[model samples]
Target: MKLATYLDGSRDGQLVVVSRDLSQAHFANGIATRLQQVLDDWAFMAPQLEELSISLNHGRCRHAFAFNPAQCMAPLPRAYGWTVPEDGGRRASDALLGPHAPLRLLADPVPCAARYAVLHGDVPRGIDALSARDAIRLLLLAAESPTHTAFAPVAVSPDELGAAWQNGRVMLPVLAMHNGRREGGTDKPEPGADFGRLLSDLAHPRALRAGSLVGATTAVLVPAMAAGDAVRFEVKDEAGHSIFGAIEQDVVLEGTATE
Candidate 1:
């Protein structure tokens, strides 16, 4: 079966596309539907859920259980808190999400256009029978993308969000790359004209001024850059210093440009 998944890191729900045998399916799962019911759903406990593992043949790994938040036989609304930034970069803002925040899926599930059955469960294993909801719930519990890096989405301009609404909040695709500029250092240069020194002038803040968007991992998302358009950024450091300057690249926004 071929499975394609779409995740909006900013939002809690996920969409999976599956193709198997000669069928296709689409599924959606979010914290609201699955987590809340787990608070008291004993039928989903580890004892029963463990049976699903038998299909895998090979045993699971250390991080296996950690892969799905929906699978734990714990309780309803199983507060799967805030996951830290995975990029291993600086987390310099107090506005970060807390660990217990909820993940919300924004839509419903439907059969896919491919040849696959949409099975869902917390444990990763093949199954012959699964309801549309159960499959997504389980997939939410079991699936993980090792390459999925978590990032904080920031807006470049208000129009980004405006355009996003018109696009059904599905076309905010962006490219990320390291800005390659070091923060601070020493040395000497022309009075107020040191280009290298001027680089660190950008501050790391939550609500930065208009233009570019920088994340905790230093991953930069460039929005729109046409030749000759003046690129600008306002850096407000931990000390609340605002250094306004022309940025090296166009501003980039993350996730649905709208929210």
Candidate 2:
């Protein structure tokens, strides 16, 4: 959904979603949900956490209290993913305290498998034509007054969105539940087990099973041209030296132009 968290600083317990528009959409678990989704044999963060060591991968920062549900309405910075930590690196809440953080739904928060099926199947076939921006817009419109359309949540990060899709995980329409229930049953996308391997498979599907980037390739991409989308691009020549190159990609929604 077109969701954004507004945190009130200079005060405690003042965290509330400033925009009624967003709250109406879906004030999801936000950071908490994201952290939980990715913890995977890793550390878990919570408020008042101490004396616990969190092992993080190189260049990967740990998200401690950054996942607080109470910190939703905090401001986000111009540069993405920067949060305001509280209690000396032990805890953190949202930063960039204000409105206008460009909140919007970036994807269908449905089960990853279902969403994938929609994107790969129904989307291209014209059953549902939505870009990440369109999804957010639909959410915002629905939130504005539940009469516009059905609601869906937006992801704070494209990777988070991709991770949900890669894992074929889904947030409940109005609730969240996980109890080993096989969602979508025989219709869910195949889970890749881990992020790194999933990403590798996504990037080079052909190199994986079926000998092509097109087979069973459930990778989802939020191209840079789309709203609330960003990516890191690395270039290397035949010798592995850095070199500039042009890359072309597209998200072929039913109503959008093909890239």
Candidate 3:
């Protein structure tokens, strides 16, 4: 099931269940108030949210409303921990921006097409690659900027990806658009590293806390983006349907005006 966090003038935001077609949504107020809350007790909470998802997708919910990416916050606005594979993997405690958030840059930085996963529970040390798959709660598309990073509108379960999710790696191409034009050499993008191995590598050093965010850059490359350059990242299925929505943002100087 697809899930998103709507901005509600709060750090955590309000949880919402989104429809399969990305056209509608319903508040998950009674089920859960924030994405992190659900993640903390995923085994018990997810099944309830999944039932609500089925109702919303089937048009059986009377209170469903239109899904708006503009009103969304990063699925987890403030993560307990954030780590990406760089220089033998880097870790940080940071806040993530929403998909529509403007990227403020002190200096021009290259935008990398990336994907990330939210951990469902703490990962034990020395876990095998195959066992690490159980730690993943959901996957998301991301745009990694030097100053900051922003995530797609929603987080999707592995089952939603079908054949594209293979052995802990998403085989689908990540399309990068620069200023409304495609940036890669071809229409399709190159897939990244094996996530299972990436996760296992991360867990080997120490135990990962629940709600930790882990990501890796895909093989697609784009030129450095200066002030006012727009970049968009997304992954589409064979039928041309967006899997995790899109991460679209414009790069702006640090002191510039932004909404």
Candidate 4:
């Protein structure tokens, strides 16, 4: 079933089960209140959620409203743990933000492709996938480094749009710009390690799992960014329809890049 966190006119929005066509929604009341809450108890909550989806689809419920992608938040507002393989960092940042992100890459964000994944649950049972539906998320951050990023306001999950890992790649449809150069492409990264591997990785020294990951893309490209540059990204469905909507990355204090 499709799920999202929408503005209920508050800071932490209400959790909702959106329609497949992206037209309507029914609030996930009682059963669950937030996306993280659902993720935290997927095995217990999913069955109940499935029933709610059925009821909403049958028009047997009230408290429903017109679904608005513009009023959505990242499926996971703040990821439990966010990791980008060696070179994919720059591209992930650029595509996630914008080409003008002002990334000061100590190393070229090319040559070495990487893996991306989201882990939730626990070290032993890390469930991974960005979203059951391909989603659009934005990260806006300003730090001492030109490349630091943070989560933005708008994020959308339209249900069942996320690409399944094929052969060994997860496609991240991307638009990038660098010094007036514009390009479009995909990023393929293994979502995350298997359960056993995840446990092993987390078992390493100083390896306390921070948050649960949801999903990720690979082959992200790194673009040169500046202080005033803007970074925007969107995730579309197989038919190229906006699922996550539009995320415009803004740079307030684009820092300088270092060696």
Q: Pick the candidate with the highest lDDT.
A: 3
Q: After superposition, which runs of candidate 1 have C-alpha atoms over 4 Å from their true positions?
A: 1-36, 42-44, 57-251, 254-259
- What value does the lDDT take at residue 51 in candidate 1? 34
TM-score of model number 4 = 0.57
Off by over 4 Å in 2: 1-6, 9-66, 74-154, 163-259
On a 0 to 100 scale, what is the lDDT of residue 110 in model 1? 12
Scored by TM-score, the top model is 3
| Two-way lDDT contest, 1 vs 4, winner | 4
lDDT of 1 by residue, 1-259 (tens): 1112223343322322222211222331321133223323425542232232222223332222212212112111113221212233232222222111221212211110000001112322222222212222221111011211111111111121233222111112222221343322122211211111111222212211211112211212233232222222222223332211112222222232322
lDDT of each: 0.22, 0.21, 0.81, 0.44
lDDT of 3 by residue, 39-112 (tens): 88898999999999999989999999999998898988888877777533565656488988998888776555
Candidate 4 local lDDT, 214-235, one digit each (tens): 2333323433444445545444
Q: Which ten-residue region of model 1 has the weakest summed lDDT?
A: 109-118
RMSD of each: 21.8, 20.6, 1.8, 8.2
Q: What is the lDDT of residue 216 in candidate 2?
A: 21
The TM-scores, one per candidate, come to 0.19, 0.19, 0.93, 0.57
Q: Summarize candidate 2's per-residue lDDT along 14-107 as a digit string, tens digits.
A: 2111111122222224333222222221134222011111111121323422223223322221212111111111112223222112222334
